[model samples]
Target: MTRPRIVIGNWKMNPLTPAAATTLATAVAREAGRVVRVGVAPPALFIPVVAEVLRETRVGIYAQDVSAEEKGAFTGQIAATMLTSYVNGTLVGHSEARRYLGDDDERVAKKLIQVLRAGLEAVLCIGEREDEFDAGATEDVLAAQLGAPLHALSESDRDGRMTERFVIAYEPVWAIGTGRPATGEHATAATKTIRRVLEEDGGIDGDAIPILYGGSVTASGAIEFAKAEGIDGALVGGASLKAEEFAGIVRAFA
Candidate 1:
């Protein structure tokens, strides 16, 4: 199968204003092309501005997170269906949301279902914490996370048939923002495990899926991670706030 070169800038909660976010998004869109696919998930409030700015460009506008509800009385939750006009995709289940917001696999799975239900794509993050890794339960942890949330999908999606609207991010919680990135081998291995679980448990074609590396992905580290075997691209953090630096990461595969 052909490798998917996709780099996503997950801006998280940064950049003081929508105009500032627009500036960064425009800069990244300047580098988009046919080589590698690039997208950005600015804060929810900024998606509209960013989406409009990058409309003619290859860069896609994404939401940092979306609600599982289609439409509901759930206050403060942005439903996936509600975001169709704003973004092309979303980054669901990032470690921060799992940790600080108490979103477990079941909740993430529901969120993923909501995303796909709305005809949007998703970058699902999964990884072991530092303790789980140290305890040699990496694969075990992954299996649980990947397996649980997937139950929310119909058999087709679980079998990996939804390649276009989905991506898996192998984000080791320990690596994110710690300034300690995973080595090429480590990232590749984690993605291999991700692919294996999908292939074995879901009958998905390994090559048909794109597994990305996330965490403290710097411009320098982007080179190896982008080209590393089994690692399709990245879900960038702080560095995504910098226009030139984030564009360089996009060019790592481009």
Candidate 2:
């Protein structure tokens, strides 16, 4: 049987202190054995510390973002190798990074390569803007954003590098951190599209690929998504900062 895959939370930019981190870590650890997989992505600064706490516990630690470049004069950038050396893995091409940090598809594609080269899994995020959704271009936008990068990979990159080697996260831009979530139907449809694209262009075996839903995934909201076909897990935002909330969300699979 295929086991459920659920990522508990992504504590983006909150919980700046050690005390706060410890509290959340303790909560996830308390209920770690309930799910197939549980992970937390804290701010880059605390990745090492959080990773230490999650070690030997049920939760895995991750960095929220990483640079496409392995090393160089890109001031203020954290390279994939550095993140892999410190944390278990890192998130790439998140909506915030695409919106604020000017990460285009080309850059994200490079980052995906970097993450894999460094021996860490890449949570490659793809999503549509609210305007695109309003214009009924959600599918088009998602295809371009999610499929283009991997499709652009060279033959070697596709066969040896990315084929079934990364996690795809579908996060609707409007839902992220806005306290609103894409309806279960919407998320399910989008994820299905993502899987089809991967199979068609990237040669990623559908059964081996894991597609995670992001954007405002809550304990109550997660149940419906957990039951959706093709939804392997979630890339949670706000709720991951609190241990209890994240644990509850994980329990949805149980």
Computed on alpha carbons, the lDDT of every model, listed in order, comes to 0.83, 0.79
Span of ten consecutive residues with least summed lDDT in model 1: 152-161
Task: Put down candidate 1 lDDT per residue, 101-125, tens digits, no spaces.
Answer: 9989889989999898788888888
Give one digit per residue, the lDDT tens place, for model 2 in 1-254. 36358574788888979778877777778876654687888787777777777777867788888888889999998888787666767788999899998999989988888887787877889999888888999888888887767776667666644543578889899886665668878988997788778778677765567788887888888898888877888888887777777777788865
TM-score of each: 0.95, 0.92
Off by over 4 Å in 2: 1-4, 160-164, 177-180
What's the lDDT of the predicted structure labeled candidate 1? 0.83
